[model samples]
Target: MKRIQIEKIFHHNAYRIGVFFDKDFEVIAILKRIGATYSGSRRCWYLDYSKASYHKLRFHFPDLVVVTESSNTTLVTGINNRDLSPIASSSVLQLDSTLSNPEHKQTQITSEKLKLQLLPSIGKYWVFKMHFHHEISKQLLKIKGVYWNGNYKSYMVFRNETVKQHVEAVLGVGSFFGSDYFTKDLLPVKGKIKILPHTEATSWMEVYVPKLVAVHEKLKRFSLARFSKSKNCYLLPAAPIVMDSLHLQFESTGIDIENLLPKNYLDKRNLPNKKQLDLSKTKKSLLDMVPVQAQTYLSSMIDTLLALNYSSSTLRTYCGAFIQFLRYFEFRNPESINREEIIRFLGSLMERGLSATSGHSMVNGVQFYYQQVLGKVDYSFVLPRPKKEKKLPVVLTMEECLQIFKVVDNPKHKLLLLIGYGAGLRVSEIVSLKWSDILFEEQKIHIKNAKGKKDRMVMLPYSIVTSLQLYRELYKGKHYVFEGQFAGEPYSTGSVQQVMRNALKLTGLEKKATVHTLRHSFATHLLENGTDIRYIQQFLGHSSIKTTTIYTHLTKTAVDKIQSPLDRMVDLKSKKKLEE
Candidate 1:
């Protein structure tokens, strides 16, 4: 028996909120009451409840004058706030008392009777009850797997032949017959059925037919309801049977339906069961399950790699990448995507005006979103990153670099440029540096929470020691070494870039160089002075030796040191001529 109750009703000027309760007195429905508010000059308004019953109870009901047929499903219009749980549960008793006959029970009102009454003019195929199920079945039928139909419900089998035997023993031959009768007599007229002869005589009959898919799906929902009630016990009569069914289906077909069950729904840990988590809200609004917000997806992805508490800059970069992915696909729903779609999307990005390095970053960003946040497997083949071009790192000459240092007038700005170039720090790393990170005695700076969130130390050159000392005398802040022009804020990367640009213009050296060029010059000059490539890589905080190799081409040290074969031969001939 299904019992529905009205939990609450609130009336406003032209709107209301109605809450409903089920047989268990659990809140099952929240109805939005929409009404018309019109001035004397406005058009007339009408409220319809015929279709609203499928979702929830509302404040207004359809006018009987317009829908005169009582068989069209009665609408409890304009109902005052009342608790209907007890009334609905005792519907049979009240109904029986009204009829004054034991034979005239509420159970006699089968799906056929109610269906016909609701739409008497329609054919059997157009039965209202069948129509409702057919619409809802569209979602359930998408699940391709093996399941069993109880008398009026369906359940996906998990495993265990013993559980099947138990269900069969309890059900007997009536299992098949009951299922058939329920489908033909109680279900909508258009519904299909499959009846089979008993195979083992336990209680179940080996029924095999595709039409049973719908029945199994509908019954599965009812079984979930039962599981929700029995918080701390075996889920069903045949747990082993359900389990074995899932295994058998998976073995025969590659689809793994068992994993499709929400992790929070079933608890297998310690083999213990707790009160089932509320899935009604989730089930009712399937759209909410998708990661609609880019921030939500990015936030979740970052939590897996780093702690949930990450810097705001890290959060923005991760989220921006994810959002760009969604925009590239025109914000297509993730459900519509597959491996090939991702492959094509990544491939198309190559010619869409993005540089190879930028494309590589995008691939990493999109890959992390799907594989980590979405929990999708088989993404290894989707992301095909483009090859980066091999090019020498741009470096400034020592004279030009000195000229830039001399041009910067602000003491704090001068120190920032010196450190960024001096220590080979990324723009982000420069902003995050603190006063305590510097160790004057050791002539090193502790780069804590650097790129990839790893900690490392960098050398502090003696040349810049005096400059830093002078800047500290002027600024004297406790935390950040490079404080913004405004009192307490850390200087941003934009501000630093502006400082570098202004310095370049003032020095009259405009070769289109960035703040990073200073670090490149530092590396190139160190290489020229005979610093090992491996040492340069560590000092520059390179994750790979390959990244540091670009500076080798710019150093000119190797080429300058080489004695060309032509030069040796020319020198020998010249010496012979002189001797002759």
Candidate 2:
């Protein structure tokens, strides 16, 4: 077995130690037995300054070398101190050459220049005066029992030998000064500010400050820091300028700023808050807002969806739609809400310029909530949904598809685009693929738990087999074929869409096409090549034949083979002229 190398150094008045060894689990067990705990922040194991602990560590590892303030000396038992050169007085400790050295490791102690003055401030506590830099400031803040004194503008901690040793180990030994020795204040007061949504109006914001400080004074000039007696928080008008100023001020003072506004408040402007408004008086103007009582009902609806094993996207859509419906009733009891109210609520949505597709979603979501969760079936007939608009899928030609593939240079992105088009797979299906899903011998790609929670198999394009093999080798140890930055998770849908957008820009194609368009083009091309409609239907995973028939209109196979009657009539007239 290879020898284990351990480097021991005194840092921040504590004995900081690190152990490097081959894949030997025994050494780890030994370190754990010694009560050495790992520090993620320091990236090492440390012990409190104790001479007895140092002697015990040397006993365990007979060949250990301890670097001390004296020189580059070996602490091993029975080793002679002859022929050792005394290092510079500024140097701390130096380990053997075989040990791995960190690039930013400090070789000399510069704490003498670090101006640290400890003095008695109040009963049982001592105040410290020191110039703050990045490294020293972080170390001082990390010391146990140390806290910032806001009034004195300095740091204070309990007086103890352990604490003094830790501070001296980091900032070096300092002299105790008289109470009035230092007068300048270097520390600044810090506080936390929380901004939440106001219940009174949409344009109003609630600011919660634990204590009135300089931040509160700065906020008063903008007429945004009025104290609310009822809420016991500061109330301000929600505006871009107000938010921007608060963000800048809190960030500058090193204060923790927490903004807890609702998604609607952050996304939209000029929205009227319905809390103070008498929304019950106006039935037609009832918008789809979340009601207070709707939370319990929405939770039950979500539980039902999860129990039924619905997809995450479907659950989010259903919950959002139901929340809107419940908000219209102002969170009234769901059992008391009749079908007439549901109809009125959906009508209000349409009047507010909701599309037919959105109207369908609202109708389905409400129906599922009432029928599935509440066990009501009679109200289904009363909630009539609008007809879905008939629209054709955008299909790119073979030449255009080739142009897209040519423009994408990234191997992973190119493979994603190819699989989308080559196998007629949806954007969601392509990203969720794993290494186990690809079957090279069978020439099939298994799609499990796809849309509608169904499973299907698509043919693997022979042309992309080599590229897939190369990609698998490049991105090893991935559960998903196209893994994200985090292991085991599928590639993000937005990233794939961005790749398509870039490719489209390079092709200079005027047609508005997305990643799904590649799948559409694949189906169209297969149909144009005389592939059976039944086969195309299975390939595209369409549940109904009617859904598959839409591609017939996009194909030119039938139209191109037929000759028009007007052209035949013109041919007869030309023949008669030639005979004359």
* Per-residue alpha-carbon lDDT of candidate 1 for residues 1-580, written as tens digits (9 for 90 to 100): 1223321111222211122221110111112123322111111122221234322232222211221111222222222211111112223222112323323222222233223111211111111122123322343234343232332233332223433334333322223211211112333323322223223332222222233444344334323322223221112222234334434322322222323232233322212122112222222222232346533544456565344444444444454455556655666755566778777766765644445665676677677667766777665545677888776767898888989999887788888888888887877678777878889999998988776668888898788988788778887876788877544446778788878988988888868788888888888988888989999998877899988888878877678778999999999999999999
TM-score of each: 0.45, 0.50
Total clashing pairs for each candidate: 19, 0
Q: Choose the strongest candidate by lDDT.
A: 2
TM-score of decoy 2: 0.50
At residue 71, give the lDDT of candidate 1: 25
Which residue segments of model 2 deviate by more than 4 Å?
A: 1-291, 347-353, 377-382, 568-579
Candidate 2 at 6: error in angstroms?
A: 64
lDDT of 2: 0.66
Instruction: Give the poorly placed runs of model 1, Cα more than 4 Å off.
Output: 1-318, 377-381, 562-580
